[model samples]
Target: MIRSMTGYGKGEALSEQGRCTVEIRSVNHRYGEISVRMPRAFMALENEVKKALACTLKRGKIDAYVQWEEAGGCAALPAADLVLARGYAELLRSLSQELGLKEEPSLGLILAQKGVLGEAVAGQPDPDQCLAQLMSAVQGAVAAMDAMRRREGDALLCDLASRRGQVAQWVQRISERAPQVVDEYRQKLKIRLDQLLEGTEMDAARLAQEVALMADRCDVTEELVRLSSHFTQFDDALAADEPVGRKLDFLMQEMNREINTIGSKSSDAEVTSLVIRIKAEMEKMREQVQNVE
Candidate 1:
């Protein structure tokens, strides 16, 4: 399915760690770019988030935001108390010497003493699990954006298809009118030559050769054939799965080249008018193609 390069989506997930929210915004861009914003605590997950988004979006200027809420189960980190530990160890040593005891207090017995160390009520969330949850939210957000982009692409495709069809019609009109132009020019040339040398001996073979050369110069058969071929390729690009904006733009240029050749080869007013209209429509299609992904 085709997808536009502009869209927005949001996703949220809840887990033992916290609530994770992901928001993504995208707009048309020639290359894929993703920028992520989140808390410092989750800064380590930026690369992972970008990689995850790359799996879905091929091209765009994507801005992603991640929000996290702490769960009640997590507790603050305990502050170590060096002063208290040293005081308790010193007091223990003094009591041992006064009691004539020779054994030294173990390191564990000092830490276990009251007021020496604080205990935690709950453990902090697992870094791995938190990252996993965040990714899940980000994936959901990308999926939502994909749906919106695809919907917008449907409209774009329909418009482009209609314009392509119109261009094809104009090319056909130019092709049919091209032959008549040379025939008309041949007659005009002969009349002009007769008027220039009235009652004088005119070389019939020379006139025929002149008319033949004019016809050859004005012929648009090759250009018409190439234009039709380009139309076929344009249709294929529309049906393609990957990004085709650049491809379509290139095809439009090729089509314009053929149209220009046809216009230059023929001096017919009708052909000029049709060529002008095709150019106008092609310009509009080009503007729309810029938004395609």
Candidate 2:
């Protein structure tokens, strides 16, 4: 099944701790890679998220956004480290006594000390619960993205199939013209020989041998055969379960090689034109294959 490399999806999962929203966007790329953006709370699970994405996405530049809103807008208050604040306060009071400073160390002074104030961490959601929620949201988003990719892929495949048929027709035209090229060359050789010899008796056996050599040298049967085989392979790859982009690319290169060889060997105007036409179609298919996965 063909799949496209570009798509978008969004999903959400809710729990007692909060609501988590995950949105994913992907585009064509040579390799699989993913980046995530979310609140600091989810940073620890970035790798886990990537792994989950890789399970569904074969190749693409994926960008994900995650958002979490705590239930009821509840939050923890700033907390004080009592030991550190007490130690600092005591040292200040001692210094004040030794220096005969009139000022007494106040509660405000203790609270203002560095590291003395920090958030009273809220009860964290269970780790398992967080991971489960994350994976669920990720799966939902990826499923939606895959649906879009499949739809786009079906459309692209239709276009590619039509162009592939055109290429096949061009190949067939070249095949039909190949044998005639040799026969025409042999006939021209005989006419030229008769004119040069002023209508004298020509050696038919020698002419036949030379014509055979020309036929062998100019034959494009092998190239057409290989080209046909590649077309079959291309169709098979399209129906394959794995990503078919690279496979299609390699087959296209092989097809190019065969068509070029046919063009060089035939030396026929019509065959040459057909080769060029097939190559144009090949270029178009290449462009489309780049977006396939």
How does each model score on lDDT?
0.86, 0.87
**How many clashes (backbone atoms < 3 Å, residues ≥3 apart in a chain or on different chains) does model 1 have?**
0
State every prediction's TM-score relative to the real structure: 0.80, 0.81
Q: Give the alpha carbon lDDT tens digit for every residue of 168-241 in model 2.
A: 98888788888889889999999999999997899999999999999998888888889989999999998887
Give me the candidate number with maximum TM-score: 2
- The sequence of per-residue lDDT tens digits that candidate 1 reaches over residues 1-293 is 46799999999989866788999999988889999998777888899999999998888899999887777735456665899999988999999999999989889989898877775323434556698798889989999999999899989999999999999888888878877887888889878988999979889999889989988988888998888888999899888877887888788889888888877887789999999999899999888888888
The runs of at least 3 residues in candidate 2 whose Cα sits more than 4 Å from the true structure, single-residue gaps closed, are 73-128
Residue-pair clashes per candidate: 0, 0
C-alpha lDDT (0 to 100) for residue 63 of candidate 2: 97
**In candidate 1, which residue ranges exceed 4 Å CA deviation?**
72-126
